[model samples]
Target: MRSVSIPDAVRCKVAAEPRVDAPHHPITLSFTDGVLTMEGELADLAAKKLALERAASVPGVDHIVDRLRVAPARTMGDAEIRDHVRDLLLEEPVLQPLARATPSLEPGVPLRPDVVLGTIGLSVARGVVTLDGIVPSLAHKRLAGALAWWVPGVRDVVNGLEVVPPEEDDDGEISDAVRLVLEKDPLVDASQLGVSTRRAVVTLSGVVRCGVERRAAERDAWCVFGVDGVTNHIEVRE
Candidate 1:
């Protein structure tokens, strides 16, 4: 295969992307044979993903090597991280409605904001945040997880949100939705996977090339509405 040299125009375009622009991100870009290598330290996983996505958008870039490190603004204890996550969730407009949902209270009983927010269970262990609750829509579930990632010192996020849509989904509908998502994802090979849904619980069984692809498949399943839980039994060949 012939190697494609990196063009100056492509480099400039990639460098100017708002996600990786300097002063805040300060990433080092290199290219060879249509492969772009991004190396730097960012605040969180979302920024790293954004930078890689932007780099891949540049024309002529065929593959990306992500070497970006997650360096939080400052080191924080687990307790502090949990507090920060709560604050962010409460402040987020998309999640405030859920966070401020008024729970059933006795007559003349003053509302407890903390109890309402507690419905969205949050637990942090070594920077890994676990969110547990039932949300009204898939959008709310996803938004809450994204907001958790934005919190400083959040190394990773586990979104355990159950979506309770207005209309309940049957097992067949959910299974079809998961399969469609897997087929549409560029990284997942739907042919090598098996998807099944029972009582809103999805089970994936198959082989993938790597752990990244396996995780990608699971994420796609989660994206489908009405999926109460995911059981990823996909084996990684490599």
Candidate 2:
């Protein structure tokens, strides 16, 4: 008897994830051999990551083709997005050394890259930003991806930044990205916001003038690349 039990099992596991199956999310799953293809719009970045994690946990699911998406902040051309990402990477004080190794946006050539750790190769095609290179730490890798995602026009981020020392990725990286997200958004006052992440779950606290600001702060938290969950603790004073 021909069997198709693996896909069924994977489906069950995926459905079991509340966030994946949430009313706001529309996910479509397909399986072929050991590869699972997940495509659709999740409520936010956390939901998208959680959905992929859920599908990969299934026994026979060896490779996952993630086509998940979150509602984009805005839309722009590839060139503009690439420039924004490049500028952010260069402007970040912590990432300055790594950014020096990044290729220049004008002619798509490396400008004295290979300075500190290794070179960062960047490209944007159809709103997807691909970053491939080596960084000194896992935090640097995550920070670069978060910056790419921070761009309003970026639809997806392919973070291939290898940590040379192979440090373990932890909650600290998530908190750092969350803090950067808050700081980048003009509507939210980062000083008034308390940012924290534990095991990939983000907790946004503090008070804002209106419910809109509060919601914006929470949404900012969800926009980071590696976030798994967001708990909004923001209060609206007005």
User: Distance (Å) between predicted and true CA of 229, model 2?
Assistant: 1.2
Report the Cα lDDT for candidate 1.
Answer: 0.69
Report the C-alpha displacement of residue 141, candidate 2, in angstroms: 2.0
Q: 2, model 2: CA deviation in Å?
A: 14
* TM-score on alpha carbons, each prediction: 0.38, 0.75
lDDT of 2 by residue, 31-123 (tens): 888888887776556667777777777888899998877666787987778777888887888788877742233356543321222367787
Candidate lDDT values, in order: 0.69, 0.75
TM-score for candidate 1: 0.38
Clashing pairs in model 1, backbone N/Cα/C closer than 3 A? none
Regions of model 2 farther than 4 Å from truth: 1-26, 41-47, 57-62, 101-118
Best model per TM-score? 2
Lowest lDDT block of 10, candidate 1: 106-115
- The C-alpha RMSD in Å for every predicted model, in order, reads 16.2, 4.5
